[model samples]
Target: MTDLAALRAALQLQWALGQEILALVQREHLALTEPGQRSGSAFEFFRQRLHLLPRLEEAVAALRRHRAAWQQLSPALRRSDPEIGALLRANEDLIFRILLLDRENQQLRLRHGLLTVRAESHPHSNRSTSGQFSALA
Candidate 1:
């Protein structure tokens, strides 16, 4: 296959991988938010997603390396490689969404301390010795 064809294929693969990673992240959030849910499945999904990282990175790197060659292609060739523009736009949108979701996840982790809870009946029922609310109280 031509370099354009290879790059286009790579872009498609990366897009698919990105979508999978996003879905896994959403699943992880679900695992976090549900009161009785187990996080093991989400952790497994994360492990699977991690296995895909190097392939995704290689595909992205290959595209970057071939970008100069891509710019040299004729307009017709560029237009024929539809994956280029579509993947670019989709990637941009996905990246923005992923960043927003990741930030929210970080905040959730900090706020709930990974959803840890004590045997106390009420959240405000326990107070520290100084009359201050603390997670460890």
Candidate 2:
């Protein structure tokens, strides 16, 4: 017996938080691109301030409980409730996009690391042979 209005509001809040996190990721990506930029400080700050992300599993679990309760509601209630449906759909899309972005970011990081290692290991070997010493000298 969940409060439908409260459940809907919680879903909306979770969706909003996800959208805010996405915005932060975009900002971090921009900061990551500058040649002379170091994101260590920003990352540390975010690590301290964004601890909510780790606790999101709790929020997600709550949402699941609420969703289950919603599902057990009468069919007429579900059909008549557009706000709940919209909130669920938005939250689902946000979570899916977050997962997709995480995978893409990991792949990009691996590729970048490989490229850096290759570049460091294989220095330019093709030196010009214009300067020569004669054995006769």
* Tens-place lDDT digits, model 2, residues 21-111: 6665555445445536545444452453245455455556766777788889888888877789778877877766755564343334334
Residue 23's lDDT in candidate 2: 60
RMSD to the hidden true structure, all candidates: 11.2, 15.8
Off by over 4 Å in 1: 36-72, 115-137
Tens-digit per-residue lDDT, 17-136, candidate 1: 678767766766676678476565534644554565465456455556555566777889888877776766676576456546654654465466632344233446544221211122
**Per-model lDDT:** 0.57, 0.56
| Clashing pairs in model 1, backbone N/Cα/C closer than 3 A | none
lDDT top scorer: 1
Choose the strongest candidate by TM-score. 2
- Model 2: number of backbone collisions: 0
